[model samples]
Target: MTTSRLARRLLRPPGVYAPQLDTRLLLGALRQEHLVGGAELLDVGTGTGALALSAARRGARVTALDVSHRAVLTARLNARRSRLRVRVLHGDMASLADLTWDLVVSNPPYVPSPRARVPARGPARAWDAGPDGRAVLDTVCDGAADALRPGGVLLLVHSALCGTDATLRKLEGSGLRAAVHRRAVAPYGPVLRSRLPWLRENGLVTDEQPGEELVVIRAVRV
Candidate 1:
């Protein structure tokens, strides 16, 4: 990540997890592809406002939404700190107001652990994606088509262990042509690893799968 990006991430409130590599990578990709610029953008699950701020910096009119009130406040504070204009709202993906965006990006809760431990101060809607880890992703995939304008794009991040194949299928089933634009493997972290057995028992993970690796999937709304 560039120094500016790092600074922006660090400016977020203390409780928010600083933007991760996947978030930076997606933002970089958006800039490289010229997919964002003076367009209306919506960021779902905009924790710490990484993607939202990045888009705002790139001249996009951004609306960032999170189900957690703290996250919304944190994101708004972060946007002000960064001196970027972004409208931060507290809402779920499905309940977002009727508005069309030229680009939609989200780093949603795709962890598949049944008992995933998250920061007590963090938003439950920011983590915990249900047993299969597809709850939030499913909502985004289903809602994106209607939320985006023609030739609009939707970028998402998730874990490889959470059935990447099925995720792509769901996106396609929702009438969005999707692709894996970037991927990286990192430590699964202690909390997700500790809940592995429960995840497997609940059919969230397979016995053959290891407890690491997250896949960042970026899709375009056709």
Candidate 2:
């Protein structure tokens, strides 16, 4: 099934993030990589297992992890409906520390928010990263090296407002060579639209800005 069709068919209940531009961007980046059959792949923060399903479609041995139980169920349901084999797990990414993959992909919570702490509940958990928007992104970058096998690849997509330079620095510091693999401009969604005033107050956006720039950062462990 095509990515768009798969996305449309996903069972995204309330609070489980719907597949959007960021998800599509990450999927595109993932498609660019050579996914050999049986190659282990991990999708962290798998919302509805869109990326995981995409990888699984390519014959990658895919594991999808999500901190939200609802998301976990949704992903598993989507996988079943798609007739795709994806190991969907419900838990924090840290819970899978013992496992490593040939590819790790994430389109994590990354919208900058006024909340001092990452939301433990609610729909915000899907996008409201605290303050500078690196709450989950930082963790993803830090864990990339350990999550990936030698010479493995990491594909991460997030808002450019979170600072691509910061992501590159973190990935490189983690011993992965990283660069922006793809970029696209997309208008802010309801979450960002609602937070526009706060974003302006925080100087994350300006009055004249058009939209957020989504970037897919691809890093490889050398």
Deviation in Å, model 1, residue 33 alpha carbon: 3.3
Where in model 2 is the C-alpha error above 4 Å? 1-4
CA-lDDT, candidates in order = 0.74, 0.90
The segments of candidate 1 whose C-alpha lies over 4 angstroms from its true place after superposition are: 2-15, 35-37, 115-125, 200-211
TM-scores, all candidates, are: 0.85, 0.96
lDDT of 2 by residue, 1-222 (tens): 455676678888999988887888887888889987799999999998889988998899999999999999999999999899999998766899988899999989999989889999999999989999999999999888998999899999999999999999999998999999999998878878999999999889998989999999999999
Candidate 1 contains a number of clashing pairs equal to 0
Q: lDDT by residue for model 1 over 122-182, one digit each (tens)? A: 4444566767777777788778888888788887777776688887888888788888877
